[model samples]
Target chain A: MQIDWFTFGAQIVNFLILIGLLKRFLYGPILDAMDRRQASIRDRIAEAESKQEEAEQEAEKYRSLQSAFEAHRAERMQAVEEDAEARRHELLARAREDVEYLEAQWREAIERDRADFLHTVSERAVTETIQLTRRVLDDLADVDLEDQLVTVFLGHLQNPEDALAKKLIDAFEDADAEVTIRSAYELSDDQRERLLEVLEKRAGHSLTLSTVTDRELGLGVEVQVANRTVGWTIDQYIEQLLDEMLRQLEADLDQRLTADVSATGSMASVRHR
Target chain B: MEISPDQIVYWEWRFVTVNATLVYSWVVIVLLGAGAWFITRNLTVGPDISRWQNGLEVLVGQILTQIETTGLRHPKRYLPFIGTLFIFIVTCNILAVVPGYVAPTASVTTPIALAMCVFVAVPVYGIMNRGLKAYFKRYIRPTPLMLPFTIIGEISRTVALGIRLFGNMMSGNLIVAILLSLAPLLFPVAMQAFGLLIGVIQAYVFAVLALVYIASGARAHQNNGEPAPGDAEPSSAV
Candidate 1:
């Protein structure tokens, strides 16, 4: 068959157009869809990885907080136990000091009572003996018997203050004080009567003067009241010394306790973080 | 054996009459023209069409599908040339059987003209796609020294296309003609069957080569990342 050039060329053009149309409409969409789907899958995979990282960080944070809480609880428990031990020690020391004080006071009281009973017995015996002797030998017993009996009763009344003076002297043997009489020679009648009355009252018995002398004021009428002396003499110096020592010790203890409390508070704050 | 009183002058290059071949080529032109009109005016993506147009579509669609599979990076660009070549060659080939008709491809002029058109069109398409410098740079691979040989080789091969088709068809025609003239009826049928088979194969070979040539030419200029000839490695598209 013969093919004219014009007709052949035209046919060729038509076929070309058909092929181009099919490609543009159908094949192009398929390729574009395929590329888009690939990119989307990649994006999804990346997103999942990022989310997984965030989850892991959250889990780590939870674990860290739990461990920190446990450590803080352990620290607080230790502090509580230490505080309980210190309190126990403080109570034990206080109990021991109180028992020692009470024992000392009871011993001092028993000694004082024994001395008083002895002095009272001696006075009664001396008085009774003098009366018996006077009845037996009536002519020689008048003024001499009265003077001797007065001496004996006054000596008995003075014994308790003397014992108190000795106790004060022993206690102050290592301390600084001067023993002396504030007033000795010039006693008014009321002062003498009041002195006798107060001495008798403090000693727990009635007293008589051995002599009308003033030299015994060196002891300053030392007498016991409620396991303590109440006169202005050398014994008061020991009381002042003891009170100062106790006050200084208590102030030191207060400072230490304050420091401990402050330290514990700051430590607790550190543990909180 | 008888000499008639008046007769048309016969120009035979060996066994083919030049005038007869010319007349047959004209007839092919006319037939293709009518087919083109029937196709162009009524083109549709829908299913309804005359059997002729439908048949043409099926043929064109099948060839387009194959060309697309070459994974031609720019199948669209080369589609017109290759598609037209396919359709024209197929029509001319089948027309050889149209009683009292001869295939234009069975003549030298037609196949030569077709091969020349491809030879010219391919380079032109190549140059257009990639400017002149880049198009010429394609021949140097698998190395530069082979360029002279390759250029000559390409030209000869395209020329050989014309010679090959002309020789084969003319030989087949002559042999069948001699047989029919001798036997008057009996042996011509067998020879004609052989002619049809040869015609169809040559047509197919011509079309396929045209496709591959267009594919190669367009493909070379395609810096679009298609696998080179020996590198026809398949890959997932997406």
Candidate 2:
């Protein structure tokens, strides 16, 4: 076997050229692509890590804001509850005051109604009693009763007390003074003359007497001289008895009303408690 | 039968001649260069790559790994020279299975030329990595008196590298030829299959040896503080 220098030289040249060709086409581009891919992968990883970090930070910020918001909401809720509680208490107080005012007005109206009813009852009772008494006396009255009332009036005139004699003398000093005799029934002429004579003797001067029939006198006689009146009549006794009865009835009604009011006040106080 | 493709002259001039070795070398070169250009024309930086690009990457990656395995720290700097050697040699050997195709590595001249390239690249890389003085100083390492032996060892190893590849490739082809004449069918086919395996192995051996030699040269001075070339494991079993 022989070695060919020319072929050897050419092969060496061919191998060198092949090296250059492979380096340019294969090694250079492939290696560069791999390097670029590696660099890109590294950069992508770094960018992903950075984004993750940023996301974590943002999440933390949001968490903090949420925490603050929760705290603020809790605080506001507490304040609102407190305010609502205060408002409720204020409204309750106003309602209580309104109830108290309405109760007081109701009690006052009840008392006023009671007073009006009592006054109406008292007036009616007094009027009815007086009317009944007057009717009874009128039914019972006759000439005798009238004569008796006149006799009683004459007796009071004839037997006058010291104070009555003075008041009678002073009243007769008026020369123009006249005596008016009023009776529930008509007086006879004899009875009128007697009544006049008795009044004249009591006065120690001659008196001018005038007789009148007054049905409201109720079997009684009254003698009026000037502005003084001196007579004994059933009307006086009846008036005194009516006045005592009215006073007793009024006292009874007042005591009953006071007891009722006290009872109502005690009940109202229990309800308030 | 011609034992080497160099014997098959296609054309001859006074001092220059075109032979089968030259012709087939050109064919391998063109096929590799065209294939590389075609596959790498649209290389993507993404994970999705074409099958041909994948194949080329595997081939180039294997070469880079082998270079690195030779204790060369920076394997990329020597990728062009060493990677091309592996690609050209392996391609020539693997293509031997095809009909009427002669492996250029079977010729003594081609392996010698390849070994010469490695021989020249060793000192070039050595000087480039270390200074020129520091690189040449490795020749007389341990003593100046051993300089001639060291020089002889360097030359002898280079020759041995060339001869080792040439002998293996040539012997396999010669055995296939001799077996074809005696038992042309089964033995020749089986021997050809064996030859195919031997061819690929020889290519790998040749490239790995070249890488180790270059690495040794480049890191010769630096090996003083690190693992010397002798102490480092061989790149391949061969």
Candidate 3:
């Protein structure tokens, strides 16, 4: 069990030298390679993080822009709707005005046609009433009717009012003024002389008188003293009755036209609404 | 087979004895150095690599992982010392299968030399990691009463590391020699194969103990930042 210090010393030196050689070649290269790999992996992770952040920012920006565009489109659509409504109102108002004008013209033409028809009817009615009266009078007349009318006229002149006497006296004062008498039938010479005396006595002046037959002065007589004349006849009585009837017919036509025009106007107003 | 390679002295020059231990240790060193040079000489920094290069890298990686897992924070600083001890011992034991070759680990001289390196390396790593004053101050920790026990524990463990490896490797050779004398045939061959297994086990045991001793000293003066060895690494990976 002897120990040799010399051999032990040499082995220690050999182990130390082997450590140095292995360290230089083997451990150094492997460790360096592992460290480089770790560094490259860290760089890649950092780049990926940066790219993710950028993509998020871009997405946010695009979302905001899209919402803004939608809002703008909605606003434009509302404006267009408002414009269309306004135009519709304006055109409708114009159409209503045209309708009102056409309604007024139609009423005017109706009124004119009604007036023309009324005029023609009134003229025919007046002529027919006058002819009917004339026929009735002709059927009922006697031989004394003419003389009776002349006598009544003479009686009026003999007992005239004061104003009538004054008018007769003024007419008699003219040197060219002559009293001319007309009758629907002929009278005798004596009757004429009698009528002249009566007139001179009633007027309180000397008067010249003339007599003639005028069938158009029907069933009556007319006298002319200078520019003044007085007479009575059946034709005048028939004409007065016809004028009253024509006036009533005109009033009735005016009422009917007024009702028709007002009713038409109400219908036109409803249409406009 | 010689039980202790030290008894076989190949040369004697003055008082410096060049025994079978020194000669065989040199042979194992040359083989290891040459093999290391050959594998590392054409290493690629890129992805494509030779199969031999891959095998060497796997071996180197495993050694570094063991040192780091034992609570040594800086594995590269300890790699030169720890990796060499493992490779040298394993190469010596594995080559013992050769017919006339003596394993250096079968001699007490070589294992003593390797254990002495671990003992000297402890203080060197502790002082370098923490300062001189802080490293020496750890000897008196718990109380000054622990100083002698701490010193004796350090020396006893170093001696145990060397003696344990020498005993295991030398006993394998002794068993094989005894079996060769009895049968000199099939039994000797089987014992020699069994000796190979014992040699690999002893090499692994020697390298792990050295790593633990070195890491314990290296981390002694450091702050309580060192994780537990199991928490730091998966033991099944290596």
Instruction: Estimate, for each residue in A222-260, the C-alpha lDDT of model 2 and write its tens digit.
Output: 677877775566667777877887777778767777876
Model 3 chain A: lowest-lDDT 10 consecutive positions? A162-171
Root-mean-square deviation (CA) per prediction: 19.6, 6.3, 10.6
User: What's model 1's lDDT at A5?
Assistant: 48
lDDT pick, better of 1 and 2: 2
How do the residues A48-82 of candidate 1 rate in per-residue lDDT, one tens digit apiece?
99999999999999999999999999999999999
Q: If chain B of candidate 1 is superposed on the true chain B, what is its TM-score?
A: 0.76
Give native contacts recovered, as a fraction, per prediction: 0.01, 0.89, 0.68
Q: Which stretches of candidate 2 lie over 4 Å from their true place?
A: A48-131, A147-183, A190-273, B181-193, B224-227, B230-237
Shift in Å, residue A121, candidate 1: 99
Arranged by lDDT, best first: 2, 3, 1
Which candidate tops TM-score? 2
What DockQ values do the models have? 0.05, 0.71, 0.44
> Which candidate tops DockQ?
2
Say which docking band candidate 2 falls in. medium
* Model 1 deviation from native, Cα RMSD in Å: 19.6
TM-score of every model?
Answer: 0.40, 0.73, 0.53
Between the candidate structures 1 and 2, which one is better when assessed by TM-score? Answer: 2
lDDT of 3 at B105: 88
